[model samples]
Target: MEITSVLIYIIVLFLSTIFSYPFLKKLKWNSKSIPYKLPPGSMGWPYIGETLQLYSQDPNIFFATKQRRYGEIFKSHILGCPCVMLASPEATKFVLATHSELFKPTYPKSKEKMIGPSAIFFHQGNYHSLLRKLVQNCLSPGSLQKLVPDIEAIAISALQSWAGGDVINTFHEMKKFSFDVGILSVFGRLDKKHRENLKENYCIVDKGYNSFPTNIPGTTYHRALLARKRLSQIVNDIIYEREEKKILEKDLLGHFLNFKDEKGQVLSKDQISDNIIGVLFAAQDTTASVLTWTLKYLHDDQKLLEAVKAEQKAIYEENEGGKRPLTWAQTRNMPFTHRVILESLRMASIISFTFREAVVDVEYNGYLIPKGWKVLPLFRNIHHNPELFTDPQDFDPSRFEVAPKPNTFMPFGNGVHACPGNELAKMELLILIHHLVTKFRWEVVGSQSGIQYGPFPIPQNGLPARFWNESNNT
Candidate 1:
């Protein structure tokens, strides 16, 4: 553990890996090809690379500093891999859409291990296509329509509970609300106590998502692995219970159970558990962040709040005095509210970036994207670019009245790897907004503060806010 010994060990490891590179390449499963003409950028210090800067510094500043020096598209080793970061819509499109086949999906080792190999995010070719199709079918418009009443019920209950609490943490509350909705929508309405236990285990799993992949005892990743095992057990138990009782429920789990791919192969129990976890993992944080920031933005601007409230109020009246569950028709009619959601997503950039690995050496704007190197579509930079949006720093929902140029606003991401659950996430937000704006009055309790970005930007104060049922507003 001495410094000199540590340095010697690192040096030996580094050299041994380099010496064994050819042998590693010939492993049949090793997908890496010889990297050639890698884009201009620094690989940083040894194995650590530029990862420290990415995690330690503010993401905006880190990206901006690099962009200023290296131009829109530049190379930098980050997060344990050498990555070519793209900032422009054109480059984003090329990597995410145009030549998407040339760039396969890649994610952190921790994410890959935790989310499982069958999860859609890390998949490609026929397998990824099958998973995507299955997910789309489960979350289709008609399916969502059937599920909306339950979603509304959950939202109403959550908001009602929030109404009675004092000085609530808005982000935490929203996460719990969304997480609960995810559980119900995916697994059908199960026992409340079991659902709560599942939520607790999921929390541990979520925390380990961005942690180092090391499985050493007492590490976050170690805890996450354990939690993942427990969650798998819980899911398997539910599946077995449903089968034993001869219950066939119409929910995501049921859809997955009955789903057969082109190969006519049904998902195994482990595949089912892994994909379910992947669904929860994808929807939970981003949805919660969007909900929290939307409310926070609305709270900061009274005029905007009134405008949003008016929009919701119109929908409320249209639904026969707000007594009905939000149908798909009603959700589609809330154009202004949709614009607000889009604007909030533009500003918040809940998912800052996503990774893709070059399947082959690719050329872009005369630069070489060497095969096997990771490519990052910098969603945050693209969303915030002045060229893409005038006065990009300001929050203006009206801008969405007319869409920006194609691929200019990818909050959920772009191309085949784009989030499949975005509509569901949007529906969850829309429902929460409809209820919140129509039935509640809320305000921040203290002076507004900046957001602290850790994996995602969260209000530094946890967005402490006071709330009252709208009836008590006067």
Candidate 2:
């Protein structure tokens, strides 16, 4: 009996060894295949992560500290998600442009709900491609050329309103101006009534966008969700009117309306409304924030402001003291002012970083980016990196005279998800700056040294300032 038991044990041991050999070999092969390590940095505490640490101080300081300690790429947990922050231009390009497929655009679920899930910002693949083409067509150079006179008119009107010298929040005023242009781009020559309705409802939605995402009644977020519904309805009303009148136009709404897929699919009304709101949301705050920073920067540097004024003044004189509408050629010719806008975009870096999610385990520069982790390309860090830009802290528009190194300057971002309306936004800036520098003088009011984030950094108190028409001053 003892011999039989010993024989059974020996046989079992031999069989186990034979079966486990392939498994052990496969494990060893996998280990050898993946030799990369996670990028160095703290993940903070579990669940809560480093969210408090991030929000407690200047986000720039937080990121700068991490980059200094851990080099360009580092790991941290923020807002309950483990993330990899990439501060190098090469890593940014790899994630945003080259290996874009390996990382997908990501936003908070609340944000997605507020912006609408079908908006091009939240999409990938064929749907995103289709929407992008339609938007590009709407804002094409041909379209923007026609828009110059109208945009000039908007700028003139905005300046005229601000000339009374009541200390107005520059950023708020810019919001109104950009929102109007956004409306024009979406709906060509919309009635004042419709425009007012859209603006009023959109303001509510905007207010709630960054509020805590609570659905309880009477909450700001709840109010925003309700206002979002009204916005959709307003868009639908416009669509219905167009269909009834059979009005075919060349605005963004027209493009969405006219699009037909190879499968003969017409976009749903909800889809149309979603994209329109998305465009407005994209166009308003960003353009306003940059314009506000431009105002502050120009105000702070009299010499630089004088130089930009000289450039625009030349065009203003050529146009016969603003009697003639700005020609597209004239708008294109303001090189100095254009550089100021570019530099403002770089210095402000309003979109400090962008969020993407790793779709699969990605090996980048000998580091392992595990699947499902959030990846942030720190645009502000890259833009401010002294190595990338000499004395990045100073506001020097001339640095842009020489083109930045490849993948180094992405004010409007890069790759498939880059801002489609970048040209339009720049055109708006040129027109506004031309009118502003040539016809108006302004001083930034109150303390000018602090920054505030209404989700985007603007000068403290919205750069409170007073404006005077040049003619009025004279």
Candidate 3:
């Protein structure tokens, strides 16, 4: 009772006034020593922090509203931490593209709550660099090309199997599809029981994404904590087995298990397991949601539907591999499909806001972001700005089809720690959609608005649509 009282009180106070606002000014903090300034936005009502205000219904409206009031750079308390919201193209480029070193991923939770401490995502400095190098080698362009067929195969299976009665929750199927694909991509083939365990454990870990910092019964965090242990054990066993056999395979786990930095120091099983799960979490949910929204938008927009299907038909016809699947070389030619997916990413901006925290006191745009204070780019602000895009809300792919108009788009984020599997994820989704659209005609069959983002929200209202073989549909 006492602890809860203190936490709520602190959160309240933190929201009402910047906890260190007065202090920041008193220190005569001049980070003018820095190169770029932060873009501006507003802080939130007292206790709730800027968290709610920034994401308040249709996040774009709030960002636009704030930018109007605050201009190009502003400060706010978000998620109980003081943060500087940067939105201008110049500011965003500094934070994301140029001065990436000054800021890095500040996901709300720690490794204990998210992955584990040794995971690649949680490592800083040399460890993160080393891990990234090793992992990159695993998913190198050539390596990724090899996995395309497998990823597409999994996607197709889910779509066909789940669409039982001309009605189905595509989001649900997409989630399952990504989960299975991620598992296969990372750990390779698995028995049904093992697959179920992986999914259930991942669910627990995912629940932790927004869970409070508590282990008490009935709390999502508690369940996630339990799941973490189970996952660690399963991964540890696999790592050891792989190590013992000295076998090599195409999966992410195999790559991690066998990796060594140039110094030749090998990664430990714990590190491998931690990084594996961390990467899987990063890959699966977001990509799945991307696929979900892509299907929704393409089907609803007639011109877009024809454009997408036409592209798919060409890919299928030209594919030396046929529907047997595509190599990255072949998939790369479908520019229209890529444009649609990129536009979907811009519109959905699934990762509405990516976060970072100051490890040292920093000054930008005449404001001080003190050590440990959180920061959010509000990527969607840049993604949806009318100045940056045409009819920002409209489903237009041509915006990205030709040369990108500068900082107008950054769906997978930018700079270091940006999604690495972008090419692989893109190929899998496009090919899946390509096969589905070319193979069957379909339509959304439910309340469009309700099918929105939850966490990694996708078309969840069950995108039921009448499907028929091409012969019947034509």
Best by lDDT: 2
Q: Per-model C-alpha lDDT, please?
A: 0.82, 0.89, 0.71
TM per candidate: 0.89, 0.92, 0.86
Ranking according to lDDT, highest score first:
2, 1, 3
The C-alpha stretches of model 3 lying farther than 4 A from their native spots are 1-42, 51-56, 110-112, 319-324, 457-474
lDDT of 2 by residue, 1-474 (tens): 134543543344344434434433332224356778889999775445576677656789999999999999999977656789999999999999999999999998889899898999998899999999999999999999999888989999999999998899999999999999999999988999999999999999999998767799999899999999999999999999999999999999999999999999999999999999999999999999999999999999999999998888888788898788899988788888889999999999999999999998899999988777889999999999999999999999999899999989998889999999999999999999989988888988889888877779888889899999887863
Off by over 4 Å in 2: 1-34
lDDT of 1 by residue, 55-99 (tens): 455778888888888888999865445679998899999988888
In TM-score terms, which candidate is top? 2
Q: List the residue pairs that clash in candidate 1.
A: none
Q: How many pairs of residues collide in each model? A: 0, 0, 9
Model 2 — TM-score against the truth? 0.92
Candidate 1 ranges beyond 4 A from true positions: 1-37
Of 1 and 2, the candidate ahead on lDDT is 2
Worst 10 residues of 2 by lDDT: 22-31
Angstrom error of the Cα, residue 180, model 1: value is 1.4
The CA-based lDDT of model 2 is what? Answer: 0.89
Model 3 residue 33 lDDT score: 66
